[model samples]
Every structure is written in C-alpha cells, then in structure tokens.
Target: MRLPGLILIVLATLVPVIWFAPLAGERDAVALFSQYLGASALILMGINQFLATRVAGIETIFGSLDRIYILHKWLGVVALVAMGLHDIIDAEMNGLRGGPLSGIAEDIGEVSLYGLLILILASVITFIPYHLWKWSHRLIGVFFLMGAFHYFFIEKPFSNFEPLGLYISAFCILGIVSYVWMSLLRPMTPRGHVYEVDLVRRVGGLTELVLLPKGRGMKHKPGQFAFLSINDGALGEEHPFTLSGAPAQDRSLRFSIKDLGDYTKRLHKTVEPGMEALVCGPYGHFSMPKGRDPQIWIGAGVGITPFLAFAESLRTADAGPVKLYYCVREQDDVPYAVELENIAEAVPNLELVIVNSAEGIRLTADRIAGDLDGDLSTAHVFFCGPVAMRKALKTDLVLKGMRASRFHFEEFEMRTGIGLRVLAAWLWDRGVYELEKRNSALRQPAE
Candidate 1:
C-alpha cells in the first residue's frame, strides 16, 4: 500500500552494499556470505527504526497510521527473517570460529538474535496479553543495542570492510535514539494545546467526547482523527479517534468512541467535565477527494463518525452528487440518523439510504446500482465500517465493474491488540457467516 516508502527503505538497505561491493576485498566464500548476512540485517534494522518513528511524512505517504503500522509490523517480520537466515547461514559455515575475546562478541550476537526473535514474535502473535506485548516490544531496542555491540567487535569483515561497519554503527545508534524519543520522550513531553472536557454524551453503545481547547487548538480537516488521552491515562491509555463534527469557531472538537473493549466501555461514566486531556493528533487522510466526482459513502455502525464530519461540513458546499448508505444491524443501532437525515434533506445533491439488516434489507452492489442514477463505475466509493463489511462490499463492487482504485477506506483501530483469535473471528464473520448464509439461500431448489 505504501510503495514509495517501501522503495526508499529498499534503496537505503541495498545502496550501501552496491557502493562498497568493490572495496569489500577478496575473501573466502564463508567470510563473504557472513558479511552479506550481517550487512543485510543491519540495514533492515535501520529501516525498522525509521518506520517506527511514525513521522508525519510517512503517515502522508501511507495515507493513515493504520497502514503505516501494517508496514511497520511486516518490516519487523522481514528483518527478523533476514536476521534468522543470517544466523543459520553463518552457523552452518562456522565462519566466526574466533577464539576467546572474539567468541564473546559472537556470543553477544547469538544472544541478541534469540532475544529479538522472542520479543518480535511476542509482539506479533496476538495470544499474548496487550500489556505484556507492549513491554516486550519496547525491549527490542535493547537487543538491537547488543547486536550493534557485537557488530563492532565481531572478527569478520571489519578488518577490511571498516567503512561498512561504521555505517551500520551509525544506523544502530540512530535506531536506538529514534526508538527512545518515540517511546519515551514524546509521551512524557507536555503539549502546547491542552484540552478540557466540555461535555460527555452517551448515545447507544457510543460515547461522545466534546473537548474545549484551552490554549492553542488543533486545526484539522473534517475527516482527520486525533490521539486523545483523558486525565493523563486515568481512563486507560491514549487512543486515536476520528473527529465527528466540523472544526468549530470556538475550537471545540467532538469524538465518538464506540464500546469496542473494556477500556472504551467505561469511558462514558469515567470521563467528566473539566477533566484535562492531551490531544496529540489531527492525523489521518480520510477526506473528500480533489475532484468533483460523485461520492458513494458506505458507513456501518460507528464507522459513520467520519461521514458525520463530512455532512456537518456540507452546510454551505457545492460538491458533486452524494449517496450515503448507512447500514446497521437494527434501526435502534443507528447513530446520528436524525442529524444525517436533516443534512441530506438540506443538501441539494445528497441522498441518504438506511439499510437495516434486521428488517431483511441488506446492502449490495446491485442494490446500490439500482438506487443510483448511473452505473457504479461513474462514482467514487468511500467506506468506514467493520473490516469484514468493507472487504465483502469492496470485492463485490469491484467484481460488478467498479475500479479498484475508486474505492477508499481507513482503519480506526491501531491493531496493537489484534491476534490470531481476532483475525479468525473477523474472517469467520466476513466469510462463513455472511457467505455461507447467502450461498444456502441461493441453493434452495424452489423456495
């Protein structure tokens, strides 16, 4: 998804090897292979650190933090694979048969490898508890530090490939420094614009947080999201949420958080007025497109939050024709239906479609096309809902003639807590539960 950033990382990892290939000097086969392995691991580690930084430019390229994290997780896995291969290759060749002092350096590398392998696996495999995963994930830089120490003191390659060694050393240092700043320094640092809770409203399974900027408020686009930490982690940890309302003249912001987990479920009662919150973002790229193409929005459950902001901003607008499909399990589950209906009625070219599955009304590509003035290919489609809903609908639309490039969606969940169970459940919901039921209905002989 983030091809440009991925390409840059690849170039950064390989360009050094290409530049220094000539000067690497003649060596035995085992020694050369060992050097290659070490260099690859070092370069990947550097790239891993760079991605972990979560800088604005990377987010811009990746389109959202969710995509950035996907890249980050995959990069870690790739780096781990490279490092594992290097370990295996070197162990088989017995290249580092150094005695005494050099053996200590080799041992350091070995220990670092095992430690990193454990930590990275723990971070990835969702079975582990969230707190444990977070702590172990932070410990990765420590192992990387050890690996750097080993790289400096190791017996091979450094004799002739001193420049390459120094380059890796710089990366290791920078990686560790970046990790420290991101995990430690930034969290501890205070913000210039602190917000106080102005109101807390509970609507169905969602809690709406209204914040009043005390000093310098964040200016953001309608569909952008922000990282909110209430009472400095009193109601659990900091989390990202999409702004539900348009930027107000008073600099007050609104966020709708659904009860997805234990921490979020207690938010309505735990949060009170006058409570101070640290709002860290205004991030994400889920917004209206540049052109005036007709927009087909598919919002499910609380995924309607961004669309709410979009509708609020349409008060005095001249955009293209718009059709919104708001899907919910039941009519009672619909949030902001009244507000959205009012906006749709007032807006000249906007049309609203409410699909309640409980009433036997479902959303499908054929249904959307039937309701539209023209073919589905003529409009741009935006979606924000359960991952399963997005995947199924997107696939169906694309199969029915919509261009893949015309579909867009953003993930609100950061995925720190995602594990095999979560993924399996998601797959089951989108796959068997939805598909099998439809298939069974279609297979009836006469109905």
Candidate 2:
C-alpha cells in the first residue's frame, strides 16, 4: 500500500477501540484504551517535532521533506481527535466523573481544551501564509510539549500498567522541545538584507538590478537560487530567483527580472540604488556538484540566468568540460548576451551554443543526443527554460539514455499581475468585500 494509505489504515484501526472503551464492561479495559491514546499522541508529536526541527536547518533538505511533514501533521490532528474520545470515555466508565455527568463536563472541557489548542496551533501554522503566521508559530512547539505533559501527567497511573505509554509521551515532548532548540538556538545570520541595489535599469520590459551586499554576502554553489523579498518586513514575502551575478569581489549581485507580475512590475518602476532587499537563499539541488560527468546546460530565454552565473564562476577556475546549450526565440531575448560571449571567448573549457530560433535554428535535446553519438552516458544535463522546451529536452535526453538524476530544470516565475487580477475580480463581485477593502475613500468599517 502507499504511505498515505498505510497511515489511514493504521488510524482507522486505532480510533474505534479508543472511542468505545467505556462500553467494554470493565473499568481497567477502558484505562487500557486511554493508555493507547496516549501512545498515539506521543508518536504523532515526536514525528512532527523531529521533521519540523530538520526543516528549520536547511532549505532544499526540508523542501523535499515537506510531504512527510504534511502527513505527520494530518496524523497529529487525527490522533488529537481520537485521544479526546478515549479520555472522556475512560473518565465516565470509572465513575470518577460526578453527579449526573455534571462533574464530567468540567473534566471533558479541560481535556478538550488541551486537544483543541493542539488542533488550532497545528492548523494555523500549516494553513496560513508565512508572512501572516511565522511569528506566532515558534510557540507551537512549546504548546505541543505542554499539551503532552498535561495529558500524561493527569493520568499518571497509566504509566504503571502501560510503561510503554510513558516512553512514547517522553519521546513526543523531547521531539518538539528539540525542534524549538534547533529553530531558536541555531546561530544562523538572523533574517536580514543580503544585498542593496546600486542600480536599477529597464531594458524594454526587463529590469536589471546591480546589487552590493551589506555583509560578507552569500557563497553558493552554481545552479542554486535565493529568495528575494523587497519589503521592510523582518521576513519579507519573497520568491526564488537564480543569482545572475558571479560571487567574486565587489559583492556585486545581479538579477534580471521580467515585468510580468505585480511585484516585478513594481520593482521595475520603484526600485532604487541603495534600496534594501532581503535575500534568504541559496536553495535548490540543481548545482552541478564535483565528480559530475561531461554535462550540458540547456537554457531557454530568461532561464539562462543561472547558466550565466555558473559560466562566470567556472571561468574564474577554468572549471569544467561542460557545454552550455542556450535557446531563445528571438536574438533580443538573450539576457546578458554580451557577457555570455565574453565568458565563452575567455574560456576554452566552455562551449556556448546559442540556438537562435529567429533564424530557424530549431534545437532540441533529441538533436543534441543524436549529435553526441548516443554517448550521453557520462553527460549530466541541466536545463531552465520554457515549459514546452524543458519538457521536450527531458523526454529526448531520457530516451537517449541520460541518467534521470543528471537532469535538473527550474520553472520560471508566473506573471505577477495575474494574482492581483484574480484578487481584484473576486473582490469586484462582492460589493461589501470591495467597499470594505479596496474601494478606498469609500472603504470603511461595516456594521
């Protein structure tokens, strides 16, 4: 069975035994069910804590692990809900609950409140966007630990019959506690500006920002990306951008952006020299690591940005025997064309193949595969381009026997104004939403 299917099956089997414990005809039997519920809580909490802490450390490591983290959270919610029934049923079956169940209300309320807090905290941290939720999220780790203590400690005697129950509770507490320590105690450079723009220019609809770092700056492997947030918020709303500038002296950073989105369009119009831009970065697994075989870089249009950086970085050390196959629909679409030529001219190790689609130089991975004499065995291919082009290249490269692990590609950012267009249209359909929010001057508090 699939991982999710297995998880659902395990939860399905465990929930019912806990729910109907009070109907089992024996007081001790119900306590046994409560102990099982406690064990589930511990297991769920431990997994969440362990993954959350690991996610805090690095970028791509956790990016790839996000699916597991999501599953762990869903499991946590299920466990929380199931355990509530276990606790309530156990209390009533033992008659420790008072007068016509009037006393049981307070106990259930206390237990449910703890369970509800866990649900709320987990749901919020998982569902809300980072900008709106991160500040309040740090305490969730504490909440999980505190909730565990409230549970196991209240039913302390369960640990005597179910020794394993105590162990699981301890694991959950430690896991979340460990997450808090890793997230807060790590000596990472606190969220701050990575570079300041020295120049912002518009070439047609594209924007080029010449950046200078305010600090020692970032040292990243080739084929990686940084998240750029141009706001004054501590942790700004950012998008991943491949570093176009070589990491050398002067700390000069270069970024080429298309005027396609609300953010990028505003950047073209408003970005100024000396403006602060927070860059939390160097994320992605696309870097051509050492020991990589004869590789080819397949670039399409503006996706050639990282190849530009890689070329310069490699040129400084006369890096490799790799070829860069770049494709652009028009001659003018080649970003930093002059720099590309300079790098090629200076490095004998580098081969720059500019396929100008304007001249009907229809290039593809299949052609490259055939031309290379079906010897893609030692070649690692990196591509960043239009969806159609990347898809074709991947299909052809794999067909030619290139190893799957050797191919890496990045998707381009969607147009910025598209999101705003959707938002505006949605609000326009609702008079109250528009009048209370964007109908500025007319926007006011509603009764």
Give lDDT tens digits, candidate 2, residues 268-339: 767778778777656555666676367788787778878878888876653457788878777565666677
Worst 10 residues of 1 by lDDT: 91-100
Worst 10 residues of 2 by lDDT: 411-420
lDDT of 1 at 380: 88
Candidate 2: C-alpha lDDT: 0.62
lDDT of 1 at 100: 49
Each candidate's lDDT (Cα)? 0.77, 0.62
Q: Which digits, one per residue and each the tens of the lDDT, describe model 1 over residues 92-152?
A: 3334333346768888989999998888778778666665677788888888878877776
Best by lDDT: 1
